[model samples]
Target: MSHLHIRPKEAGADKRIINITPESANWQFVGFEVVMLEADDTLVVNTQNTELCAVIISGVADVTTQEQLFSNIGHRASAFDGIAPYAVYAPPKQELTINALTSLEVALCRAPAKGLYPVKLITPQDCVTMTRGSGTNLRHIRNIMMDNVDAERLLITEVITPSGHWSSYPPHKHDTDAIPQESALEETYYHKLNPKQGFAFQRVYTDDRSIDETISVEHNSVVTVPKGYHPVGTPHGYELYYLNVMAGPKREWIFHNDPDHAWIVNP
Candidate 1:
């Protein structure tokens, strides 16, 4: 398997599906994990030196930070439910706990921090929903912790692409630190399909083709984009959903589209 393509291990209902750290990814920032929990089960997160953002992918969860209680924190039985989720952010060196009020699925996104921020509960009301592209390029986006939100090193979001649609389209890249033009950000795409048995396609490549892979992504799998113009497509029958975790030397998310495919955006 290519280092960028990560497959999930066989997991039971109450187990972590995927876990990636900066050391494991050979990158400077970005860490991700997915977990499933039965009702009343709990998980304690040791933030260490990294900030943590826990996004409830499904079911309800209660988050506790120090003395604060953020309760009943989620909606929708699936990401395809067309609703935004609840997210909790915990600062570095601190610990937070998640108590699953119901069967829960959550994604933990992390990055290095200086302990400058506080624990914050980002509700669906705090998120901005926008639809990008049109026709077969159409996709729905939930901007959970983008630039407008208060966070030091994370720019998180979730996207839903309808069947017969494309997403992260026009083949965009953000591997350069040229501030005005593009920002260098390492990203991960954690994908899930409506039917557990269905699959999707994602392509990661550079202008020089130094890194190129067209992956058949199964449910709960992830694709790491260290540097490339990455784009995704869904099969005609399966709706696609993905959570994106991005971070880098800076926190900006400016990207440049591939010139060869830029014309599509103009028409």
Candidate 2:
């Protein structure tokens, strides 16, 4: 098992498939988890010293925090349904409760914070949907919680890659704390395939090849990138959807493209 590739845990009553803590990864900044809930089930998130973003990836749920109640926060049944998801962000020292109105799949993204923001619901309309690249490099992106949002240190997004296409293309890295040039952020990719049985591929590597490996990613798999230009690819028939959670010393996203592949973006 490559350090970068992660499979979910065995099914439990709670169905929290993937759980990645910063301590578990030996990387500071990003902590992520995904859970599947049955209708009427409930989950409680205690935010201690970190802020959280609970993304209602699919199905309906009522997400409530001390400061807000985001009721019936989802609609699509699957991540690949072409619908931007509903998410809720809550600050530190609070508890966010999620009660499923229908079967649900939610992602919990966490990062260190100073309690600077209140709980807020991020509607689909608030997300920016855009198409990037052309040809095989083409992909769709939904900015769930990006720079435009007011968060102390979390940048979240979702991407849908068509079958046989590439995403996070032109391989980019943000591992150097160069401010306007590049920001060091640890990232986690939670992936899902349309058919649920198909697989995708992701490569994580640094410029020097010191940390290079290509991973075969199965449905619900997670790939963590601590420092590298990571890119993803889906096979000919399986469309891919992934939720990305990023956080580090800086909250902004400023990545430097791999010099060798820089032309793909420039040309």
Candidate 3:
């Protein structure tokens, strides 16, 4: 199966821009969708049997759930704004109605859940924004809902790589649960380019080169990593942004980096 899945802007139908489920991606866990809503428009979302993280990529929206209501929960004009975006989490069986106060773009990340966690509205202050790597490998990461967060099996975050830099550098893989070394997890990347016409390159491969692919991704592209070491690079003159969704048997973010290039992280 192809690891790279692209969903172009014009491919959206009925406000659903991108949709990926366990059955669609052929993964046991993790699913995602990108939704666009016009001003004053509303959409009802049911978590059903999965836990979901709804991230507001752009514009303001009011999210109403059975327990509480979040009014005007977003403010970033675009994904490239360098501002921390707002996100909401809902556990299984919860229903949420979202009313767009302006033209909005929301990313829904889902994963199978066995317990019902409380609904949470993750504001900008709640996010942990950090810089990773160094020099040419520098990138910004926004941990929206991490392991410390109250969730059953989902981890959500976003990363921004400047031009000519690497984001998921050193080629990391977490397809096994080798405690203190790595944890098995399924992941997906939903990408967006600054100029829209620009593109980036991503490589998904295994240590033995059994499964390897170098994919060229553009705006609104989605890439799934079932099991492999994945790394991405942004070309000069273009910035790259990707929303990352991950899920697995364990609620941890441990990973093992490629031994060959592991020195890059230290040197």
Model 3, span 10-110: residue lDDT tens: 53435787888899888789989889999998999999999889999999999998899999899999999988899999888999899999999999899
State the lDDT of candidate 1 residue by residue for 213-255, as single tens digits: 9999989999999999999999998999999999999999999
lDDT per model vs. reference:
0.92, 0.92, 0.89
lDDT of 2 by residue, 148-225 (tens): 578999999999999999999889999999999999999999999989999999999998899999999999999999
Each candidate: RMSD: 1.3, 1.0, 1.4
Candidate 2, residue 26: the lDDT equals 89
What pairs collide in candidate 2?
Answer: none
Best by TM-score: 2
- For model 1, the superposed segments whose C-alpha errors exceed 4 Å read 12-14
Q: Which of the two candidates, 1 or 3, achieves a greater lDDT against the reference?
A: 1
Native-to-model Cα distance after best TM-score fit, residue 27 in candidate 3, in Å: 1.0
